[model samples]
Target chain A: MKGKLNLNFLFALALLATAAVLPLFLQRTSGGKYNMIVLTYAMIWAVAASSLNLVLGYTGQACLAHGAFVGIGAYSIAIMVERVGINYWLALPLTCLLTAFVGFLIGLPSFRTRGPYFAIVTLCFNVIVYATFENWTWLSGGYAGQPITLPAALSGRLARYYFVLAFLVITLLVVRQIVKSIVGASFLSILSNEGLSEAVGISAFRYKLLSFTVSCFFAGLAGALFATASGRVDSSITSYLHSFYVLIYVLIGGVATLAGPVLGAVGLYFLLDRIKGLGEFRYVGFGVLLILIIVFFPRGLVGGLNQLRDWARERRSARSPGEEVAG
Target chain B: MSFFVNQVIIGIQLGSQYMMMALGLTLIFGILDISHFAHGHIYMVGAYLLYIFSVLLGINYWLALPLCMAALALAGVLVERLVYRPLRGTPSINTFIAAIGLLLAIETLVRGIKKDAVRVPVPVDRSVSVLGMSLEVQRIIVILGALVILLLLQWFIQRTRLGIAIEAMAQDREGASLVGINVNRISALTFAIASALAGVAAVLMAPLGSITPEMGNLLILKAFVIVVIGGLGSIKGAIAGGYILGIIEALGVAYISSTYKDVFAFALLIIILAVKPTGLFGERTAS
Candidate 1:
């Protein structure tokens, strides 16, 4: 019972699997297909948000330039595949490499600042990357937006959905592994006390740079998937606002939990989208919710639920005489 | 020479505006250690409140300025007590995320109220020729108003007992608290002063251009750039950085491409931060 995460972990896994094949269950109506496509977008965002969680939640470093990295990935794919006529398959790996390299350059200097200083510096970087994307028409296709699509074999709607879902699975699994690994422990140690970690020879700088590059690699992957899945990459994708939304997902879903970003990305995405009359209230609501969540439950939805479960168990054990003590 | 002088006037005007924005950010960061990312949006809200009081309620523009400032002071205190106070002792990133959340909420709320941009009627609707360049009365007012407020702020921070306590708080929160300086009062006061300064900037600049909810977005980033360039919490640094940024932007636009007008400050930020992480005027502090 103490290792009770298994049940919820499996539950989150079920929900994600449902997102992948839900179209197969639903009639092949346009509405069904539309929902599937939205989920596909959410899946990509889940990957992006999870990447952020790897750095922000686990490592306790908030790299706010996440949206810029996503933009880099999107543009990498679009520029290579759309303009240079490179194969999509080839551009996929190239996009990841390019984004990781960029992340390394950024993280080297960025890790120099810590905590909120780091957050603001990264945010400034986001502003610069976005400005470049908006102003560099020759490369970014300008604000009019550049078109991109998957290979013909993967161009089918269901194929694109499955492709994004597959990547989300891969990101979550790898992130889980990293979180449970010795390197993951180092990230947490730094998060708790950087000076202490450094004093103990954990090399806080190297670990942070590693987490940042890894997260950025996934951000790029997600961006490339978004470009192909949505069939376009625009300055809109590069907007600093996108950074806030990605952070929002991780915060609301559950920071530090592997299932948190996935739950957050998919749950909040659908809730905001399905509620048609929400209009501007959606952002206002998300903002207020984000604040309230941080104030009340810094651990997020998953963390909140885990606390509730613990409380409920304690109450049950107190009330029942026949039950052995629950952990 | 005329072009250069005209550009200098524009730079001074812009420099004052940047000072208004950056000072608040620096003040908050110094005293409270939160970046207050929503400041640009708060400035936008202050503009909207000014619009509501002056245009919507038919109040005089000058009268509405103080009214807006007072209201935002109340708002700043409330936000401090509510949004930020609860998350104290948590990680700095928590507060930063909260700031982003608050920023989004405020921007969208204002957008919901009014999506289209509207011009605030210029209280001083005239121009003057200076150094062979036509300077509008409104532009001069913006510069003078900002400079006056900044000077007053400088005096208050340096001279007053409360201001000295505020400075002490900025320098050392724990030390200030231990010495019987009410950390809560100073924190709330710092936020109030910061928020009101932003309001003052917004009110002054509202007449110079059309106002929109999105106006604060770019301004906030530039303000952060200024704050970063000046050293995060240095008042003098913020002031210097503000003017330097404004002049660079004005001249860069005059001589270089306007398309990259926004990029100049950002480039300056990266370069300055790379060279001197302590900022040009920031003292060395532990990470």
Candidate 2:
């Protein structure tokens, strides 16, 4: 078990090392500043998707308000910097706190429902947030969109890319720690059998609230990163469809796995980017791909790859026995 | 007083459309336990079909209306058979994802076909003054049309053999199947009938607003609110919840603030969820 854990740690470290230097590699090779921008956006989405995985993937609650939480993060930063004149870096952590409070308020009422009902409540929250963002002109800049001025340190594309990459790593590590801790165990138990867990005195409501607040915090953090990286905050960020996109990212990457959301976010974003010229027709292709993935690869890409690996190992073991018999 | 009455009257008109959509959604959820997220897109297609048959093909409005419903009913059955049937018995979330996928695909397909919204040209553009009010003739027709369809549906469900079979299956799938009811046939029928209702709603509503591919997204959101407010699987709840929502939205828009019209439905939903998770009329095990 220790050896396996060490191997997993080493793999994660290697992946993180690669990610840390990825912007430099891209700057030297492709040399297109646009590539860094896209990569940074992908990393931001990766953080958001991973946060969603905490609730939808692990805790088994299909919270669709994730987009709203991210929006809150963005708007909070936008409001603080543009309106109240706070430092951008200081505003990010504050945004996370505000989002967590909002999550707590939503989660309290949402605990009364379950399954699809919970999903709908979250969706309603999404709409409510969108309406607020649209109408509260002073805070979110309404439909005109609020432009964010990145600090000089992050004004460059490579700096923003590395900055977002660092946050993505932080998000993954924080979520992984949570997933590996006692709280994650309780979350999984609640997900697997809520009634039984409640009956056994696990206090599903409290844990669910915890999961929701924590998820929103990370999602908000991602949003702040996105706002600075993209240099704008818009009402569209809070739209329910954005929530659906993040959900798709987590699902397609493989839920319940730390690596899945990152892979899914980057992979699918690039896929959409590749077909950007198609205009609205691109969404048709995307929708078709979503259906195909859900139908054929419900466990997601990582889950499918793991299954293949296990199958290959079994085949190898079976072949070794056959060779021994032949000998 | 007249202004308040006007809003109430208009609210009822809007509620009728929501009722039509919610009725179908509740029926499907009753039997299949799937939210049928694509129902709004189905309504969008039905309106498009109405546009095609009535405007493009030059069919009579009355004839085009029924044809649109019939076509959507067939489409609904195809959706069930081709997409949902194979997904039966899987985790409910898979079907939910599939429904969302269908929503995206269908909406995008329609958008690809026509990027711009089209106005539905109906025969009556006149409004009749009644009780110090000027209500659109088409709006009255939509209300009466919704009432007639809803009544016919009630009669069919309560009296017909196939309808009784559907109710039985909805009440107890295993028991109904054991009693020799064809479960697959009934499931398909439920989907068809529900989808047909959405189509009828589309025809009724086509005259009220310009038809757009993106309209279904908001329509579905409202329909979902109605379903949850009324109770997920309760027919009577759907009817009641639909009017409640419509009236609340209208009154709120008229009296409180117009900009917050959409927020009222969600606020009511959250309150209901917190106070009574099963819904105002829901009796089922919600989880």
Candidate 3:
């Protein structure tokens, strides 16, 4: 349970508390309708980033094809609902499973290579999937935007927001339960030392594939929610750079920490979207923020705050009557 | 028959450009153990710099070419020293993320300044007949330039003390340092040389296409495909991979649909990776 908390635990807990209160906080900002919209998408992206954390953070597998999995989920649900007349709810779960199956297939070849090669292979897979989505017009509808028709039960902005929020809660609970289990410990051991874990009978390939498939399961959920909630599906979601954005979210948040990805996804999405009204400067701002954070706080924002908290704790303890000051 | 020859020639020219980029990319990977994902963006900056020097300042193209290389070399050194050097020995993912961040910053900065895609006029616009083919002089220039640069690079890496130092550093960083090699100097020099190669590539590519901030994204992706196909850290493999990809692309475009030409490269990457995970020429180190 201690895992990486020695690095960013307390700050992550604080951030989780803020996430719990984010919905009510956003609802009060009713005047900023555009901010509400941004909040909705940010939450969707948070879900995506969190699923990525399952594979990337928890399992230490850099599965860069995540955006494609999300896109598959989006397309699967959209096509099933609009073209096949399946109920949206029924279509959503089915599509998520389909996405996971595809993820397992992708992971088979990708996991053969280690580390950076793994990243590159998965990246190529992302591009390949994007190409298919773009050229196969009948299947994906390409850039024209595949239309997503939501059920009446989840219509309107507030309803959609609540719907996405409910799923986010479920996703967090699922991830938390997994993280607390022995399976999670196996993942950590793999991260800390893959050879040792494998030598001790952990079957690295099977566990990695399982981690990837489960992560894709959540990614598909987020994608389906995004498609139905946003009213469209597009190949742009599967772009290789979309996976980079998810990486940015996970890395800028604390790696291996649950609350960190959510904080990063929400904070960064809001900053670049709402605050930077200037069209071009937003990316410059983003790049600078990423560089500064990675350079100064490689452990990300939670880690930075953890350092500050510990520094203050050190100061308080030093001032106590327990020891003499040398300097 | 003439059409096929032209496709091969086109492939060669494209391969020339890719060879330069992939060589730089592989060298950086060899030395720093960093992927340097922004290598293409550095090429993108070189194109813009060429435009600024030749088109804006009215400097002659030849003069602007060297200036672009020099400026980019300096930029590469600064990047190595200020940005990436600090991230050394950390989890490679941190460095990879930093490189991506640097790429995003470079591209956004260029976009903010220029706002529109621009083209540099070809320095040599005349067309000539070569073996029953009508060829643009600029194409010959690109081919010759890349060839000369390759030879010069080969000499530098093989003959010079600094170059040998670079080779040593690439082979084993700690061992090189232990043998009295200055790690910092080699890192900067490697960055400088690699970036200068990218600059040459940019100059050659600038006349052929429009220079946009986002141009680097696809170029980098293609270069990665080429690099992976050849093998990471193998110069010969990079060259072979470049030509192979170029020919496949040219032939695919000539025979198949141009719309999915890019997909072929991605598919090739997957196929090769599936078949040989360490790369075709790679005796990869298990890091």
Docking class of predicted structure 1: medium
Q: Model 3, range A192-233, lDDT digits (tens) per residue?
A: 788999999999888888889999999999889889777889
- Point out where model 2 deviates above 4 Å: A1-10, A28-31, A318-327
C-alpha RMSD of each candidate structure in angstroms? 2.4, 2.4, 3.6
Candidate 3 TM-score over all chains jointly: 0.93
- Per-candidate Cα lDDT values, in order, are 0.87, 0.86, 0.84
- Top candidate when judged by lDDT against the true structure: 1
Scored by DockQ, the top model is: 2
Off by over 4 Å in 1: A1-9, A310-327, B285-287
| lDDT leaderboard ranking | 1, 2, 3
Give the per-residue lDDT digits (tens) of candidate 2, residues B1-287. Answer: 88888889889998998999999988999888887888999999999999999888889888887899899999999999977887888777777777877888888888888989997786688988877889889988988988999999999999999989988998899999999999999988998999999998998889788999988876777888888877779999999988888888899999999987889989988888788877888776456
Clashes of each: 0, 0, 0
Q: Residue B126, candidate 3: how far off, in angstroms?
A: 2.6
TM-score for each candidate, following the candidate numbering? 0.95, 0.96, 0.93
Residue A169 displacement (Å), model 1: 0.6
Candidate 1 residue-wise lDDT, A1-327, digit = tens: 545677767887687777755879654787887888888898899999999999989999888888999999998998899888999899999999999999999987787777877887788789888888788888788767898866788878788888888898888889989989999999999888989999999999999999999999999999999898888888889878888899999999998988889889988887878986968877998899999999899999988987898899778888985684534
- Candidate 2, CAPRI quality class derived from DockQ: medium
Q: Chain A TM-score for each candidate, in the given order?
A: 0.93, 0.92, 0.87
Better of 2 and 3 by lDDT: 2
